[model samples]
Target: MLEKLQPNEIVDSIYQINLSHLKEKGIKAVIADLDNTLVPWRSTEIKDTLTAWVKDVKDAGLNLAIVSNNTSSRVHTLSEQLGVIAVSKAVKPRRRAFRNIASQFSLIPSEIAVVGDQLLTDVLGGNRTGMYTILVTPMSNHEFIGTKLIRQIERFFLKRIKNKST
Candidate 1:
């Protein structure tokens, strides 16, 4: 299971991604999961740190977009503040959402990076599509009921992977 990636520690909010590293890797655009990945799930507004980071990422010549399985209102509100387009109700771990987002950026899967906090959704989705996936720890563990349940299963698998590696 560790074969797919060298799992990384959380970047401490979206603001912390090393833009230079990303640029060196030819990552011209970022397609991110908005909820737990960018902010606490359902968070209404962008934080000051994130707001600035968004600009930094853009200024560094990287385009940004949000791919979320949320309502248009929620995604749009956040997208407007972050200066990025958003695809609401993105069915992740499936290629459809990624495909649509990629089209928006005029990018191929290889040139776009997907950032999120979940393993099964973000990591798997990006990996499936051959996009670089960055798994950041969620800002808050308190999430939707369904997510809480999925996270339980995700942790179980993660622990299993760790044990075998040890």
Candidate 2:
């Protein structure tokens, strides 16, 4: 059970992810979390660096999508601005959304990489669907109240995972 929560890779932010490395690993598409992973939690404000990274992902011949548990309006609005596919209200840690994205992209699970800031949601969901998972540090402290609670539990797991790795 705990193994399912483990991320295949951990990075400080999405910007640190190497596109070429992903390509080399045979990843054809990327599914990203919306809040914190892309923009700050609940914020539509996009950073120039993020725009450039998105462009770079496209330039490298990779498809991108945003899957968020946030409202449809919030997710769709930001996805449109970024020109990427969006799946809103995605209850993560479930396989449905991840599987659907794979189907939409016409790619198998192994061909997609799921990137997000949360282990329980993004990482667990991706792993459950057999997709490569990358975990990034949260962009800001601001988050939903429920997420704040989940973070506390996540910290405990993170520590255990770290200790095992060492």
Candidate 3:
């Protein structure tokens, strides 16, 4: 059960992700978390670098979706700016949104990757649906109170994984 929360890849940020490599692996879509993963938890505006990253993903011929547990308005706004689909209030760790991404892209589970900063949400949810999962460090130290608590728990699990691997 705990292992399901483990991510297939860990990176410092979305920029570190190899879009071309993903395409080579036959990845057809990416389901990414908006808050913390793409931007700060409270930020509404998209950064220039992130804009280029979105363009690169699209240029690579992979579909993209921004899925978040945040409000629809927030997600929709960013998704529009990034020119990707948005799934708001996604209640991650559940398979509903994951399945939705697959359905929306007309891709199988193995052909998509879930990207986020949270293990409980992104990794666990993606793993549950048998999708590739990538965990990136949060973009900012600042986070919501609920996310802070989850981060603490995630740190513990991450440390355990690191120690075991070493």
Candidate 4:
């Protein structure tokens, strides 16, 4: 079943997350989303903070990679520059890319966390693959065509979260 996780499980921002804590939890790897999750969906340059974040992940002895639904060019550019593995045009929530990422890294699903801004694609995909999922706020109001539609649906679930929060 798709579990409705709390905000703590989702994390407020990428910087606030503690890799050591995740390591303690036996989470040794990460499969992250690119658009909005890491960048502004179309921003080409990586900020110092993002670069440092990736460095910290590696420094923490964690295997990391980018799994994006975007084309190879974009993911490859970002992944190569950041020194992480990548799978593009991922078609997420389908399990193909998620399974591939785990296999490539020789990581068990339980040992990985998938971080993304969208609940429908990233969160659902990660959960289906039995990985911990982190749903963050989108970097920009603009989203891909399909993602736009999903946001509308996500609001319904978010409303439930809001009600519970109150």
lDDT by candidate, in order shown: 0.80, 0.93, 0.90, 0.84
Question: Least accurate stretch of 10 residues (summed lDDT) in model 1?
Answer: 1-10
Tell me the spans in candidate 4 whose CA falls farther than 4 Å from its real position. Answer: 1-8, 161-166
Candidate 4 local lDDT, 16-73, one digit each (tens): 7789998999998989999998888778889999999999999999999999989849
Give me the overall lDDT of model 2: 0.93
Cα RMSD of predicted structure 4: 2.0
> How close to the true structure is residue 154 of candidate 2, measured as C-alpha lDDT?
94
**Error of model 4, residue 94, in angstroms:** 1.1
TM-score for every candidate vs. truth?
A: 0.89, 0.98, 0.96, 0.91
lDDT, candidate 2, residue 33?
Answer: 97
| Backbone clashes in model 2, listed as residue pairs | none
Give, for candidate 4, the lowest lDDT window spanning 10 residues.
1-10
Instruction: Enumerate residue pairs that collide in model 4.
Output: none
Cα RMSD of all models vs. native, in order, equals 2.3, 0.8, 1.0, 2.0
Of the two candidates 1 and 4, the one with more favorable TM-score, higher being better, is 4
Better of 1 and 4 by lDDT: 4
User: Where does candidate 2 stray beyond 4 Å?
Assistant: none
Cα lDDT for residue 67, candidate 1: 88
Q: Which model scores highest in lDDT?
A: 2
